[model samples]
Target: MMRRPGLALKLSVLLMLGVVGAMVVDFSLTSGTDMDRARVLVFVSIALAMALLAAVVLDTLIIRPLVRLSAQARRMEDRGYAEPFVPTGLDEPRELGEALEHLRQRVLAEREELQRLNAELERRVEERSLALAAAQRALVEGERLVAVGRLGAGVAHEVNNPAGVILGRAGLLLDDAATPEAAEDLRVIMRQAERIREITGALLRLGRPSRGERGAVDLAAVARSAMELARHEAVARGVTLELSCQASEVDADAAALEQVAYNLIRNAVQASQEGGVVRLHVAGSTLSVSDTGSGIAPEAIPHLFEPFFTTKKLGEGTGLGLAVAHGIVRDHGGTLTAENLPERGARFVVRLG
Candidate 1:
């Protein structure tokens, strides 16, 4: 920007021009006489000089402060705000300076307010997105529970018949307790038979909606414990079960988290081709399961976690593994996402924060 002329320079230029003009006019009006010319020059010079002096004083006292105030305003407009100069010993300029400073402060406050509003807007957008995603997941889980209830009804009816026979026969054996050896073996069998009942009961609980309170739990520990239970299946399938974990905790049920890990690992093992690697890696606060098998089709990625949605052969899978896994993660305040790996496989990333 062009620098404004200083008051001293402006006043000096104005005064010089005025004097020169007066000299010219005076010479033009005077008669062609040396004495008259000298006298006219003196009078004109004096009058012009006094007028120039007055102009200088006014500029120093009035015009300069006005210019400084203008510069202060422009600076505030361009740079948001800054400390302003206060005019001393003058009512008008002091008042004007205070007004300009107030204006600058107001503009600065408004600018800050605008920034705050923008940040708030972004936060709300993120919250809405998370809520929408959570609601959609909830809907999918509700549908899965409904299907599980139906399947459990059928499975219960089928399995309960045999369970009743096994329980009845074990009770009869226990009643005998004739030989020490026979009783020990019978008791062992009876206990194992009773365990099957417990498992079926647990499955029934899972098929129904859960009523557990939220609480803090350790995800890494839960995952490791679940692995101990599911290791046999991975071994049977000739797939390696590997876990890379970190110290991580979350607000969730320990049992539900175990179920989630169980479902995820079982699915990973099943998804792998024979002799494939099923890696369970937990980093920071997220758990990931990856398998070396044919990746899920792009079309199926979106529906993989839905109940009864399966990519396996007709009888190979019940398809409730991923659906149940999804529910478990949601109930624990987390997320489950599946994607096709870059090379040739599927990876599921579960985040708990």
Candidate 2:
């Protein structure tokens, strides 16, 4: 890159040339006088000293301040507004410096406002994205449950007949068994067939729509009846059953509500550990069943109410309990929801009004 002479350098060169021209003029004018070499030398020396002093004063008062102002402008252009800017020099230079500082302040304010707006936009977008995803998940879950209901409605009808026939044959063979062992074997067959019949019956009930009469029934009374039914199972499992009823009335099918309450109570009882407590609470239009046992598995929560989705060991649970309970609650124009307690165990809440 080619370098240009600075203000100071150019002024110094011009002053030197003027001093040499003055020396020529002086010597030419005094060439015929009695002036000697020492006097001429003294005159040249004085002129040279004055020229150097003038250069130093002009550079300090004018050139250096202008150079500093240019550097400040460059810093402003780069958005270094954190430091306060002070106008330098006098007259027009000071005014120009003040104007540059004002422009820098305005730019800084605008940039800060833009950044705040961008952050707000991002937050809103994230909230909308989360809401959209939740809605999509709900849509898919609804479609899946409807499909399962339709399939179950058909399968239950077909399975019921064979299950009944097996139950009948096993009962008949048991009555005619020659040995106790044979009778016990036939009884096992009967028990298994009976289980199949119960499952088909539950499926049929779940797939069928609610058509029962609705009336004002006491929610507390219904819950108490359910607790009584589950009392035997709780005792057998060494779990305690505690019931708290508030005598709240609600418009619902009495039989259906009783079934839901019974299912929830029975599940809670089964989930409780030995010597653990199962609590049933009925207040207003709500019924909650809580058990003091290990909390529900997180992975099983999403599919907890889906038909045939169970966390139970084989031969322990058919997994249709919660599915059927959920369907019954929906048919009653109510809701059934399950969640794990913070400390321990799980809770099932039924709301009907």
TM-score for all predictions? 0.49, 0.63
* Candidate 2, superposed: residue stretches over 4 Å from native: 1-136
Candidate 2 residue-wise lDDT, 1-353, digit = tens: 95343211112324421332222222433344446656656766676677767666555655556677787777765767776556766556667768877877888899999999999999999999998997787567656765787688689889999989999998888888999999999989888988888888878767864658889999888888888888999899999999888889899888888888888888888888899999889888999999888778999999988988888898788888888888888777677889999889999999874
RMSD to true structure for each model, in Å: 12.8, 9.1
lDDT score, candidate 1? 0.72
User: Predicted candidate 2: what Cα RMSD to the true structure?
Assistant: 9.1
**Mind giving the per-residue lDDT tens digits that candidate 1 earns over 1-353?**
96343211112335422432222331343335677767766876676677677677656666667678878777765775766556632467767877877777787799899999999999999999999998987676667666775577467556766876887897898788789888888888877667556545544544652456667766678778888888999889998888888887677777877777888888878878888998888776688888887788788876787666788887566566776677667655677888888988888888875
How does each model score on lDDT? 0.72, 0.79
**Candidate 1 versus the native: TM-score?**
0.49
